[model samples]
Target: MMTHPSGLILPESRLSDLMREHPHTIPVFLRHHMVCVGCWMSKFDTVADAVWNYGLDMETFLRELNQSAQSIPPQGTD
Candidate 1:
């Protein structure tokens, strides 16, 4: 798992996979609503950029992302 400086813990799984399963994060993308979060490009993108690009609150966005993590089973558990 890769933890971002902003505290976003990226799973070992690819961004495409994460977004594929967590389509609900769509609302977080304020800009480029059509941009897919789980795409390969997003893998290198940081959570800070995501919020800034989407015009979101860093704290709130982090909270939401962490909350999203709770619903997902930890790696190797599935």
Candidate 2:
């Protein structure tokens, strides 16, 4: 399992917790056609489970997610 910079464990991080911590990730889930954004199961499912259920490439998907998270502008800069 990979670890997010915020210390959340990837693959094992509950989708709800992840989304709450990084709302930016919601778009990624949408782009991937993942309904986890609003699904109740998000509270119980982990990122890895989403990947497996969607048949996504783990390495690539995680890389994209990391990239998206990194793109968030530093606070107070505009």
Candidate 3:
């Protein structure tokens, strides 16, 4: 199993909850063309499962997810 970016996300983490908790990550999903962003299955699928189902590599996906998370400043920071 691969490590996720941080508390921001994890492979075993559910996609629906992640998006709801971290809206900033939407770009990462979009960049990868992950339909799970709006897919009903996102509620039940983990990032690991979703990536694999979408034919994506776990490490690469995590990398992009981390990068996108880092790019976005916190809600209070400017």
Candidate 4:
């Protein structure tokens, strides 16, 4: 598990749980071509596991994920 500065999402966070908790971060997953959005493995996988299996650099991926989260405006305030 990686520590995110924003602490909004971390590499150890469960994909399904993250989606449920922070739907706006979906773009990050799509950008990475991740299939966890609709995959059963999401129930058991964490961001770290996905990135590892996908052969992605954890630091870079987490940076993008956090950035995606930061870029999205809060709901009802847009």
Strongest candidate by TM-score = 2
Off by over 4 Å in 3: 1-8, 73-78
Give candidate 3's error at residue 37 in angstroms.
Answer: 1.3
lDDT (tens digit, per residue) of candidate 3 on 1-78:
222445456788787767766678888888777787889778888888988888888888877776666676423311
lDDT tens per residue, model 4, 1-78: 322445567778887766665567787888778888888888788988989888999888877877766676433312
What TM-score does structure 4 among the candidates reach? 0.75
Considering lDDT, which of the candidate structures 1 and 3 is the better prediction for this target? 3
In model 3, residue pairs whose N, Cα or C atoms come closer than 3 Å (at least 3 residues apart or on different chains), thus clashing, are none
Q: What lDDT would each prediction earn against the true structure?
A: 0.53, 0.74, 0.72, 0.73
Q: Which candidate is the best by lDDT?
A: 2
Which residue pairs come into collision in candidate 4? none
Which runs in model 4 stand beyond 4 Å of their true positions?
1-6, 73-78
lDDT of 1 by residue, 1-78 (tens): 344444344433344434544544445553346374545677666565565667867677666656765566434313
Q: In model 1, which range of ten residues has the least summed lDDT?
A: 11-20
Alpha carbon lDDT at 12, candidate 4:
85
Give per-model CA RMSD: 5.4, 4.7, 4.7, 4.3
Candidate 3 yields a Cα-based lDDT of: 0.72
> Which of 2 and 4 is ahead in TM-score?
2
Give the better candidate number (2 or 3) by TM-score: 2
